[model samples]
Target chain A: MKVVDIYRAIADSTRRTILDELCEQNDQTLFEICARLTNNHGLGLSRQAVSQHLETLESAGLVKSRKEGRFKFHQIDSTPLDEITARWPADASRSSPDASRTTKRASTETEEQS
Target chain B: MKINWTSIFVTDQQKALDFYTDKLGFVLKHDIDMGGPRWLTVVSSEEPDGVEIVLEPNSHPAVVPFTEALVADGIPMNQFAVDDVEAEYERLSSLGVTFTQEPTTMGPITTAVLDDTVGNLIQLVHQDEGAQG
Candidate 1:
């Protein structure tokens, strides 16, 4: 899952709700997913809207789907997500106090060049 | 209006399940498996139709980003309407839940901040009956 793609998948409140419902169950059919989302997640989004969001998530590779006869189960794709996070670029959000590591590293390179 | 489904993002679904169902007295509505992971949702024991609070795993990149940013910036998520903020704060504290910030009264609203065992900051607000006046 690309970081930007995953970020967009979670940007919407309704999509976030759907993701939570799917994660709670780990897997759910399209109908069950929609029902759980409507009943348990208060998505209030139309069935069509829910399907659209599911499509977006599926397209982003954040979720996996399988067709079982007439049903489709949705769940988190841990492998893709793990790989994406593993390759995350350092930002100020990290635990370390020194977030200027990037600047520091650049200065060291410049010194070596000079 | 009856709410049948609801979802909540959490760092650990199990702890959240225990907190809502056990401590808050919400009854377990459905616990089923989608496949590798199981679905667990609870309803208010008193008002099942009011709202569904879904217990969701914290895996979404945006959720992670928003929660971390909020924490770094110091803001609480949705504040839960409680009968008594201090009592809820104390009861929750005994359950091993940490209150990062104690109940502080700002005029009419008395609120306490609690760490919901995850990145989320849950708030208990005491609706000052007189706050409106």
Candidate 2:
């Protein structure tokens, strides 16, 4: 699977929400996914639209769908995202002393304000 | 907190990748294959670990209208910080980047806008030295 595909899959905000829904509760049917998106997120996308989005996600390896009886269940597969987050080492950004100091100062100020 | 990932929608991922890396001088950070579209990302060469810019495909049904409206209004969807807007603008122009807005100074910032060739207008900006102080 090409890494660009995962980025493409998640590029759409709606698709991201679908992934979030699946992550919250895996093995959701198409109907369940659409209902959850509308009820929870106020997204009233058509079932056909949502299904197409799922196909894109599935093609990118960000989602997996299985058939059980007459229903097709979709599940989130976050391994592709892991590759994205792993691109830059944890300490790469932390190596900047000025940035770290600025963060510390900002957090300290926030703490004092709170 | 630091930003780890940010994305811009592109009509074509391959075209955007070439424009971003060749014209914008960003380095390819990740390019993994899933099945169809690859999970591609790029980072600025100056800040390799700063933030990864994902060239996302605008495949969502609603994306067409949203992007169209933004483009119609000549509004940039994303902005990139540069050391010098004029210099970057000139460099990019030499490399065939079409600028919708020339480098112009406004208060404490200088900005220029360019078409990313993938259905998005990207802004390049530079904060004036000592503007914060």
Output DockQ, candidate 1. Answer: 0.01
Candidate 1 wrong stretches, greater than 4 Å: A1-114, B1-5
lDDT of each: 0.67, 0.80
What docking class should model 1 receive? incorrect
Write one digit per residue (lDDT tens) for candidate 2, span B36-88.
77799999999998889988889998997897666543457799999999999
Lowest-lDDT window of 10 residues in candidate 1 chain B? B69-78
Tens-digit lDDT track for model 1 on A1-104?
33347778878887777777666666554544555555565555665677678788887787788743322457777455665565554553464656477676
Taken in order, the candidates have interface RMSDs of: 18.2, 20.0
- Best-performing candidate as measured by TM-score: 2
Cα-based TM-score, every candidate:
0.48, 0.53
Writing each residue's lDDT as its tens digit, candidate 1 over B1-133 gives 6646756788787788887777766887777886755587887777776666777788788898877655432346656788888888788878777654566554577776665655666667777786674
